[model samples]
Every structure is written in C-alpha cells, then in structure tokens.
Target: MRNENQGTPRRTNRFWVKVAGVGLIAGLIGGGIAIGIGGAIQHHEAVVSTRVPSGSNRAGGTKVNKNKADLNGEATRAYNSVQGAVVSVINKQNVQQDNGILGMFGPTQGDNSSSSSSNGKLETASEGSGVIYKKSGNAAYIVTNNHVVKGSSALQVIMSNGRKVDAQLVGTDAATDLAVLKINSANVTTVAGFGNSNSITAGQDVLAIGSPMGSEYANTVTKGIVSAKNRTLKAGTDGTLTSVIQTDAAINSGNSGGPLINMAGQVIGINSMKLSSDNQGSSIEGMGFAIPSNEVTRVINQIVKHGRVIRPRLGILYTDLANISAKQRQSVLKLPKNVNQGSVIMDVKPGSAAQKAGLKKYDVITKMAGQQIHGLAQLRDILYAHKIGQRISITYYQGGHVHQTTVKLVP
Candidate 1:
C-alpha cells in the first residue's frame, strides 16, 4: 500500500510540470507579439519623420521651413505703401521768456510784451501727425487734427524723409476736428488714397501709421482689427457728438491725425483719440478711435471749397432731457411720464427754421425724420443727414401732448 501511494504522488508531480511548461511557452509567444507590434510602430514613425523636408525638422523639434514663415505679409505691404505719406506735424507758438523779476511782476500794464527785450520766440507747443492726401500744381495738401494746429503761431511738417517745411493752414473746422495744410509738393513722393469707410466691416484688419509720441518715432505702424463702427462719442466742451470708428490699434498722443489704413493700403479713417481710462479712473486698453474717412472726405471737401463746413442749422439752444432731474422734467418742463428721452429746447433763434416751424421753449424733441431722437447727439446726427433746403418732419412733446411738423432746413 505504501509503494502504490508513492507512485501516485510522482504521477501528480509530472502532470503539474507539464502544465508549467505550457504556461512558459504561451508567455514567451505573447511577449514576442508585443515586441513585434512595438517595432512596427517605431518603424512607421521613423518613416513619417523622414518625410519632412530636407532642412526642416519635425514639429516637436526647433528647425522650421523659412519659406513658409515670411514676415512680409499683408500688414507689411500695407505699411510700406503708406509710410511715405505719413508726416509729423509740429505746432509752434510764440512764448514769452521769463526775465526773472519782469516775468514775476508781469509786463507793466501798457508795456507791449511782444516788444520786450526778451522777445517772444516761436517754440514747439505740441506735436501730432498728418497724412499727405493730395498734390495739385506745386502744392501738396495734408490732413491733420484741428486740435493739433489750434493756437499755433506757426506750423511745420516733418516729411517722411526727415525734411522739415512750413505748412500753411488752408482751412480748419473745429466741429469736425479736421484741418488742411498746404506745403510745397517738391518732396511729396506719396499721397495716400482714401478708401470708402462705408464699406468697412467689424473684425477687418487695419494698420495705423504715425509718429506716436513725436517725430523721433515717425512712421510707427500698429496692426489691429476693427472693433466697432459708427460709434458716436461726445466731443469738445460744447457736448458735440462725433461719429468715429473704433479699433484696437495702439494710438498715443502724437498719433492723432494719422492715417488708419486698410489691407488695400488706403486710408479708411483718421486716428484721433484713445480712451485711456473711464470716468472712474480705471485703466482702459486697446480702445482707439478714428474719424471715418467718409466724414473726413466730406469735411475736407467743404473746407477746401468754402474754407469751412457749411451745414444746415436748426438755430436752437437745447439741453438733453437726461441731463435734467426727474423733478425738473415733471415740474419745469412738464414732460409726460412716457416722454423719457429727448432734447429740451431752451431757446430758438428768431429767424431760424425751428422758430418758423413753431417750435418753442420747453418743447421736447422726441423724433426727427421718422427716427427716434434719444438726445442731442442723435438729434444732431439726424439733422446733419439732410442737406440744406431739404424739408424734414419733426416730432415733439409740448404741453404734455405730442406734435409733428415739417420744416425746411437752412444754413
């Protein structure tokens, strides 16, 4: 019985050994398959990596194709085309020298400071930018911001070639903030063409070329996209509204009156002001404004033709309804509750269109030409849309009642 049991244990051990051998063979075969697959993947990757151009490495590596990374793209070309037309405008004003005690005490009441021993000398008052837009006969015309040339006894223009020449103020319009200057065309090599601002769309790429702080940085070009169109912002102390194009291009103090160019290398707008901060003193960025080229063209043409922009005038003094307190609106103006927004006429010129049309003091203008008038800005915008001698309808509230009338616009 002991011999038989020992023989049975030996058979069991043999069976277990056979099973271990099969398991070892299967593990080896599976590992070989995995190794084969990994080798094939590595080979495929190597073949693909070699397919890259001869001098260029894979994307993960540093080397790249120089042919595909050219810097002379549309923005570069556009800047090059208009760079010669950009100029720096210098405003020179007569300044009195401080003659110690004399300056401290001031010029004796009748003493002509101009004739004082310390003669008034012309010095740079401010610096801005301009664009050469036209050349006729021996003179070339430049367009710049009116504020740039304001209060200047003399104006000088620094051309792109670094040549400085005297500029004559041909015309200036304060309402539009535009001025035209005439200079000798001898050195004027380029004149920027005006593009149709009416055709410009939001998100279109644009370039701004100017001398951003002064002439030392002349021909500075900034690239950005149009952020908005037909933006109306309050301008000047009179609360006048100016329509402008908004862009993200970097514009600084000296960039005013510079050309805002499109991809076609044409001037689409004139760089004016940038909002650096809100009323709360918070910093604002990438908010630059430009006068549309269409408005620029219109104002320039009239300035060149008549030395001023002649617009149809209503000849009425008014205040925005929103400026008045709700109590004043209800008690003084007697405006209806629904009459929330409008311009309140304070006075009317005797011979003006408003007077002739029976518009009186305290009349709240609610609409003009069938368009709603939110305030003085909207009223001015709509009024300017019509030409002189054209007749338009006006809607207003008077004596707590709505009224409509047609009146002829006159200069």
Candidate 2:
C-alpha cells in the first residue's frame, strides 16, 4: 500500500500524474463575468472587493438565485465569492520528438527536406488555473502548480474578466509543486484570501473554481465535500507530501493550480493532482488532492522574496533500501539479520555535510535528529526541519556496525 509520486519510475503504471495538458492550441478565447479591479496593489494586503450591481446576470444572462440554488448553500456562496479571483494560466513551449527505429525503416520516400521525420519541431501549449493571492504596487502575485509553468517559453494570465496579460515567473519550488507568477496589476480584480487549512474537517462542503479543460470552460465551478484531510502523497523519488487535502470536487486536468474554497469564501487548498485508478486499471473517481493553503503560503512567501526557496541539503544521493529486493539486500549490502530498512548512501558530495561527517558510500542512514528513519522520505522530512548551517545528529550503519555523528547542514 505504498504511495508514489506522479511519474516515478518504480511505479510506472501506479504512479500519480500531474494535471497539465499537451498539444494545446494557441490564442484560445473565452467568455466569463467581469469584475472590475481598482486601487494600488500592495504586498500581503487584501485586495479590494467590488460588489456586482444588483440584478446583474452572468454573461449568458442566466440569473442564479444565490439563496435558492439546488447546489450546496455554502458551496454556492463560496463559489460566487471567490470566482472572480480564479485565473487561467497559459504556457507555450517548443516540443521536439524524434522518430526512432520506425523512422529509419520507413517514410524515406519523400524528396522534400521540409517534410522529413528529422524535423520534429512542433508548437505546444498548455492551460491550467491560478489564483490572484496578492498585489503590490503595479504588480500582482499568482500562485499556481509548478507543472503548469514548467517548460514555458512564455506565460499568460487570463483574468476572470477575459483580459489576458503577460506574466513573469517570479519563482518556483519543485519539491512542493508550487510556483509564483507576477503580472501587471491594472487588470487584477479580486484577490482571494487564505483560510486556516488546519481547521478543515472531512465532510464539510467545498467549492472548486477553475478553467477545467481550458479557457472554453473558464471559471467553471464544481461543488463537493471534503473527502479527507492530511492525506500523504509522494512528491518525487526522495520526497513525500505529508499533508495534502483530499476533495471530491471534480478536479480535472486544467483545474491544476486552482483554488479550493471553503464556506467562509477563503482558499483552503490548491488543487494539484488526482488519483485516476488502481494498479488493476479500474476507473477511480472522486479522489482528487490539493496542497494545503498553509503550506502554500509558506512556500509562496519564500519564493516571492528569494526567487527560490532555500532548504538545507544533506548532500547525498541514495536509494530506499525498502524498495530493494531481500535477496539483493542480504547478498550485496551485508546488513545484520535483524536490519530491515534504511537509506543506503550512494554518493556524498565533496566537502558536503555528509562528507565532512565521514559518511561514505554504502553507509546506511538509520536515524537522524532523534527520529528513526526507514527511507529517504523520513530522512528528508527530518533534515528539512533544521535550518541551514544548523547542526544535527545522524545515526548510520556501516560494515554491520552502528555509529552516530553530528553534522551541520548547508544550503
């Protein structure tokens, strides 16, 4: 019952997948309600809210009776309150694909060089959703999933009012799958505020607002209840997301980076990825997950100020011994009969904290900073709790013997 990160090699079919798109068209247009934004943008300052005129209807002239809608009462209210802050994020990138053995065996009859398999250059675009979380002077800040803007040659932010503006990548943190983008504040309207993610409970009504699919469905709203809380998911080969919020609010591919709002009209989470199916290949529904807003704020603040989030690194590359076969463990690493799990260090960087502490290849880290470690995830979690240049104790096993040493962390 081990969880795996999206696109991990070990769990090829059982892995998670990021919510993004491929082969997307360019210059897609959309229609949605407009909310006007005014005044100067300021850091950490709440954006001014302007109420829609009474009797005003959506672009299609459909009137929504806020009080009598069949939808969840609190969800409807939350959606209407925060919809104006949801945005569409567009990414453009150059994609190149090379034809392999098949190309060498066929399709060489064409005499023209322009239509050959060698030229695999293509134009690719993708769309995801984002939220306007802050404004400072002429700039506004957007928080989105890192996968949304990962390989962008250019980025654009489409406001809830249908106005599209160029956005600059402020900073990105891959370990957390979050990114911050900045754009001109002129068209910025409603900025969503954060709620206490720690207070969210299962079965509470929630709303998801985003462009689910593309601008064609911009600001689409879905309603559901919080399915679960503090669900752990793999982040990468060596990292795990310890506290993601789970919801059943129909989070699709384009919904990545969008806001998950609570009844109080505050953002509780950022939709990131969804579980599609079991290893047996059955369809899985109502299993979407999001990054808690509290964690989002912590990473966003660091990214906004530093252009990157800095964390202490132990400067070692290793594989989880748990993933290795028992035969290999017994034959190669030569651990004691009772030893079952640990992180086997493969390489320690020269002059690194591990190297300075006399850690070497094949040394299995069994504990760190007083916490027992089973694999990389636990070790990473424990190591990251300490700040840069802080000293911590490490316990490891080498040549069937246990040893402990104190090492100072570095960026």
For residues 229-312, what per-residue lDDT tens digits would candidate 2 score against the true structure?
Answer: 877687422365456889999999899999999988999999998899999999999999988888799889989989998889
On TM-score, the candidate that comes out on top is 1
TM-score, one value per model: 0.75, 0.67
**TM-score of candidate 2 on Cα atoms, chains taken together:** 0.67
Residues 1-411 of candidate 1: C-alpha lDDT, one tens digit per residue = 366576888899999999999999999999999999999999999999898666744576656656866579888889999999999999999876644345666544445434334256899999999999999999999999998999999999999999999999998888878899999999999999999998999999999999999999999999999999878885432456877899999999999999999998999999988999999999999999998998899889888889888899988999889898999888888888877888999999998999999999999998999998876767877887788999999999888888999999999
Worst 10 residues of 1 by lDDT: 109-118
Superposition error at 191 for model 1 (Å): 1.5
Q: Which stretches of candidate 1 lie over 4 Å from their true place?
A: 1-67, 99-120, 237-239, 323-341
